[model samples]
Target: MMRREATGEAAPRTPQAGAGPVPAPLVASAVLGGAALLVWPAVFNGYPLVFSDTGGFLHQTLGPLMLWDKPWIYGPLLHAFHWRVTLWAPLAAQALLVSHLLWLAQRALRGTAAPAAHLGLCAALAAASTAPFTVALLMPDLFAPAILLALFLLGPAREAMTGPEAWYLGTVATLGIAAHLAHLPLALALACMAFLLGLPRGRALRDGARTAAPLLAAIVLLLATNWAGHGRPALSPHGATFMLARLQADGPAAAVIRARCPEAGWYLCAFADRLPMDANDFLWASDSPVNRDAEGRARFLGGALIAPEAQAIVAATIAEHPLAVATAVLRNALRQLVTAGIGDTLGDDHLRTALRPRIAEGFPARERAAYDAARQPRGVLREAMMPLAPLHGAALLLSLPLLAAGGLRAWRAGDAVALTFLAMVLAGALANAVATGGLSGVFPRYQARIAWLLPAAAILLLMPRRRS
Candidate 1:
C-alpha cells in the first residue's frame, strides 16, 4: 500500500471529477456567435431605424452627444462623445451588449458538459423572443436585456462572490437604474435574489444600498440638469395644474392629446385624453371648447392653470366614483402594457406629417404616411387581442404563483436563476401596466419590455433535472 509521507497512511485516490474546463471549441463558437450578432445589422440592413421610437431616442441621445442644447438627462452617455458618432453608436452598443449576454449564458451553464449547446439554445430562444426586437432598435430596449444579463452574471448564486464580483454587480445595478426607471424593478428583483441566494441579509442590504446610491445621485444630478435645460423644474405647479385639467377630460380627447404631444412632462393632458368618453360626452364639453379658444390655448401653452378648480373636479369625480377611478387606473395599467404607440411614434404619423413642412430635416412625408398606415394592422391585432390581454395580467393576478415558483426554484435546489428571471418578467409587466394603463392602440414593442423573462422561464421548464 502507498503510504503518506508524514502520516504514514495510504494516500486516497480522488473520485472522478465532475467539473471540467470550458471547451476551446465552445469558447471559439461563442465568440464567433457573438461576432455574428454584433455585425447582424450591417449584414442584414433590414431594420435600420425601423421602430418609431428610434428616431426620438437617437435624437435625444445623439443630440446631447453633439453638444446641442438638448436635455442630456435622458441620455446618460451623451457627454461621452460627439452626437454624430451616435449614428453608429446604437449598433455598436447593442452588439457589445449582445456579446455580453452570450458570455453570461455560457457562464450560467458552465458546469454542464455541453456548455456551448446550452448557451446556443439560450441565445436562440432569446433572439426569437425579444433580443431581436431590442438589438434592432435605437431605443432603451437593448439596455433591458443588457441589464438582465448583468444581473444574472453578477448576482450572487449558490456560491459566494469574490469582492470584485460584488463591486461589479453593484455597478451594473447602478447603471441599470440610471438607464431607465423601468429597469428599477429588475434591479430590485436582482437584489432580492442576492439575499435569497445565501447572501447574508445585512451584507445584501448593504450591497443594495451601495448599488443604489449612485443611481439616486445620478437622478438628482439629471434633475438639476433638466431644470437648467428647461429653465424650470421638470414639473412646475402650472404644468401640474394643466396636466390635472387634461386628465379630467375624456379618453378619446386624451388619446388625441397624447398623439399630439407624446412628451412625458405633458402626461396629464395625455392621461385626460385617455379618459373614457362616449360620443355625447358632455361632462367636460366646456373643456373641449377651451381647446379651440385662443385664450385657452394661450393659458395651456403658457402653463397657467386654475389649479384648485381642476383638482376639485378630479377629486369630486373620484369621490363620486372611487371604484370607477380605481378600475380606470387598473385598466390604464393594462392598456399601457400592450399599447403600441403611447410613448412612440408609430401612431404619430399625423404629427410627423404636420412637422414635415416645418422641419427641413424630418422623416419624409411619404415614408411617414406609409409607416403610419402600416401600423393599422398592428392596431387591429391589438384590439383583437384585447380579450387575451388579461392573460398578461397573470403577471399581476398570479404574481404569487410566479413569485413562489421563482422563489422556490431559486431556493431548495439552487436552480432559482430561472425564478429571478421570471420575477423580472412579472415586475416589468406590472410596472408597464401601472405606468401606462391597459392596452393602448400603440404597437407591440412594449411587450418586448419583458421579453428576457420568457426564455428564462422556458429554460427552467425545459431543462432536464434530477428530482430533489
Candidate 2:
C-alpha cells in the first residue's frame, strides 16, 4: 500500500474471470514446433548440407588456412559458433537469425503480425523453398538475402521501428553484408539505387544512414580481420584476377595477351602458347597457368607483379571490347536469374584428403561420427525440387511489377511502410543480381539466395491494410 501510494500506481490486474496466462506447455510446444519447422530440411536430409566450399571454410578455422578467393569472416564465425565441435550449433544460430529477420520483415511495411504469424510464415517458407537449406548449410549464401532483408527493414521500414529495434536491425544488416565481399558492394549498390529512385526523399536518408553505418563498420572490420589473418591491407585482392578470368573467357583478354606476350616476360605470356579456352579452364584447371597448384596463381596473388598486370589487361581489353564485355555481363545476369539448380557442389574429395585430418584434430569424435553418418560421403540434391525452379524464376521476373503496383497503391493512400518495403525489395533484388551474377559470373546459388524475395514481395503486395 505504501509503495503504491508513493508511485501513485495501481496493482496489476489479473487476466479476468476464467482466462489465466498462456500455458507454459503451449509456449514450449510453439517453440519446439517452430524449430522443427525451420530445421526440417536438416532432419529430412539426416544432416545439414555441406557444400564443396564448406571444407574451405572449415579449414580456415579448424585446420590450416587456405587462400579462399572470397571473404574470410564466415570461417571464424563458424568457429565461434561451433561451440567446441558440437557441429550443429552454427546452423542452429543461423536458423535463429533467419527467423529473427523473418520476424522483422513480417513487420517491414507497417504490417502488423503476431509472433505466431511470423513463425507460421517462416514454417511455410522453410517447407516450400530452398530458403531454409541455406540457413542449415555452411556456406555464406544465406547472408546475401538476409542482408537485403535487413536493409529493407532498416532503410525503408525504419519509421515503423523502435529505437532498440533499429539498433538490432542495423547490427544484423552489417553482419549479413559483411558475410561476403560480394555482399559489401551489393549493399552500397542497393542504397545508391534506392536514392536514385527517389524513394529515400525525407527521413529515408537519415534512417538509411542506420543501414550505411553498419556496412561501413563491417568494411573496417574486414580490413582489420584480413590484416590480422592474411596480412592483407584491403578486401580480397582477387577482384582484378577474377575480372581477368571473366575477360579470358570472353576471348578478348586472351587475344590481347597474345599480342603483348612476345616482349612481356609475364608468366601468363609463357602460357599464351597453351592458353585455356574458358574462365574455368584459365582459373581452375590443373593445366591452367593460374591454378593454385600452379606457380602462376601464387605469383599473381603474392603481391608480386601479376595482379596489377591483370588489372591493366582487363581494363585494356574492356576498352577494346566494351561490347563483348557488356554482353557477357548482361548474359551472365540473365542466366543467373533463371538458374534453378542448388547445392550441386555438395562435396569435394579435396576436403576429405586435405581438410578432414585437421578437423579431426579438433573436431569431437561424437560429432565426427554424426557428420559422417549423415551429411558426409556425398549425396545429390533431390530432383523433386527441380520442378519448383521454374516457379522461382517466374516469381523473380514478377517482383518488380508487384513492388511498383504496391508502391503506387500505398503512395495514393499515404502508407510509408508499404512504399518503403516495396521500393527497397525491388532495389535489393536488382542489386543482388548485379553483384553476384555480374561479378561472380552466373551461378544458380547466387540468384537463388535472394529469389525467395520475389514470392515474398508478391505476398506482401497483396496483403490488405488495416482501416484507418
Candidate 3:
C-alpha cells in the first residue's frame, strides 16, 4: 500500500517529476468530490426545494426571456440556457464552477504539497457540508464560494503575472460581478492586495485597471441589457427605492443595534424571543408606518439599510455611542459565526396551521384541505427537531475555536496564502453581520458558505513544511 504524504510537505522530486504519476492531492480531492455528489441529496431530502427569493432570481432571468430578445438578463451574457433548463441548470452550474475552483486551488498549491492537501481537504469538506444548503438553491449564495475560491487561488498569482494573467484576472472579475454584486467586494479586496503586496507601481495600477475594466463593462452590459429588454433596468428602481427607504428609516445606528441584537426576526421581530431593538428600531418603525402595521415584514428588509442614511446613522452612533456600537458590532460578528436558533421554522409552522382553516373555506377546497392536513404532521417533525437543533448548533460553536487557532498560527507564520484565506473569511463574516444587522432569523444554511475556512486554515497551519 502506498503511504499518503502529509499535507504541505514537499514530495521528493524524481527524474521524471514533470511526467510522474498524478499527485496525491488531486486524487484525494476527486474522491471527496465524488462522495459529496453522492450523499448530499439524501441528507436534505425534506428541505424545501425552493429557496427564499429564488423566485425573484428566476423572475429576473426567465422573466426577461419570456418578454424580450435580450442577450442577457443581468450580466454580459444571459444564462438563457440556464433559465430554460431550471431543474438541472443551477446544479450543473454549481458542479462545473466548483470543479474549476478546485483545479485552480490545485494550481495555486503546486510547490507546497502540504498546503495543497489541506486546501483539497477544505474543498472536499466544504463541498460535502455545504451542499445541503447551497446545491439546489437558485440564489447567488451558492456561487459565492466558487468566486471566493478563485480569489484565493489568484492571490499568489498577483506577484508573477504577465499580460495574459491580467486578462484572465479581468475575465474572472467580470464573472464575479455577473454572479453576484456582493462579490464585487472580493474583487476590490484583490486589487487592494495587489497594491499592498508591492507590485511595481505602474504594473500594479495596470493590472488593477485591467481587472476592474471588465467588471465595469459587465455592469454596463447588465444595465444595457435591462434597458433594451425591459423598459428600464430591472434592478434599479426597486433596489434603489428599497435601499433609500431603509436609509431614511433608522440609519446605521439602527443597523448597528440590529446587528448586536441577535433575537430580532429575519423580517419580523416575532419569531425569536431574544431579539434586540434600540432607537434605530424606533426610528425605522416611526418612518415606515406600513412596516410597523405589518409588524414582522420590515425586519426582513433590514438588510437594505447599508446605504447612505444607515451609514450616517452608523457614523453618528459610533461618534455618540462609540463603545456601545463597537460592542454590538463585535457581538453580532460572534453570533454570526455560530449556528444559533435563527430563521422561521416555528413561524412557518404556525403560518401553515393558520392557512389550513382559510384553505378549508376557499376554492380547490378538497385538495387544499388535504395538503394542509398532511403537512400538519410534518410540523410535528419540525417541532421534534427543534430540541435536536442545539446539537448542530454546538458543532458550529466548537469549530470557531479551532478556526481561531488556525488563523493565529497562519498569521504568525507569515504565510501570505493563509493570511488571505483568513482575511476573506473574516471580511465575508463581517460584511454579513454589519450588512444584515445581526443573525436574528438567519438560517443555519447560510453559515455553510464560510464555515469551512476555519478548518482549512487550521489544516494549512498544521501541515508539515517541505524541505527547501
lDDT of 1 by residue, 1-468 (tens): 133444322222211112224466765566546545544433333222234334443455434231122234334452233243323444555555565455443344332324455455546543344444355445565556566555554542313233564455446545545555445554555455544532422335543454345445545654565566554544222323333432443243344344445443332443344354432222224444333232344223222334434454455555565665566566655665654321232223333433223222433444344434433213332233234334434433343454565456544444434444455445545655453233122235665555444544445434543221
What is the TM-score of each predicted model, taking all chains together?
0.58, 0.83, 0.57
How high a TM-score does candidate 3 get? 0.57
Q: Pick the lDDT winner.
A: 2
lDDT of 2 by residue, 253-340 (tens): 8888898886866667877866537675666555567744345344344322356778888888889888887887777777766663
* Ranking, TM-score, top scorer first: 2, 1, 3
Put down candidate 3 lDDT per residue, 98-170, tens digits, no spaces. Answer: 5444433433333334334534554544443443334434356554555555554444434323345445545
lDDT of 1 at 281: 27
Overall local distance difference test of candidate 2: 0.64
Candidate 1 at residue 83, lDDT? Answer: 40
- Winner on lDDT between 1 and 2 is 2
Candidate 3 runs further than 4 Å off: 1-43, 46-49, 65-86, 110-132, 158-173, 186-190, 197-218, 229-235, 244-414, 438-448, 464-468
Local distance difference test scores for all models: 0.43, 0.64, 0.43
Score residue 329 of candidate 2 by CA lDDT: 78
* Worst window of 10 by summed lDDT in candidate 2: 11-20
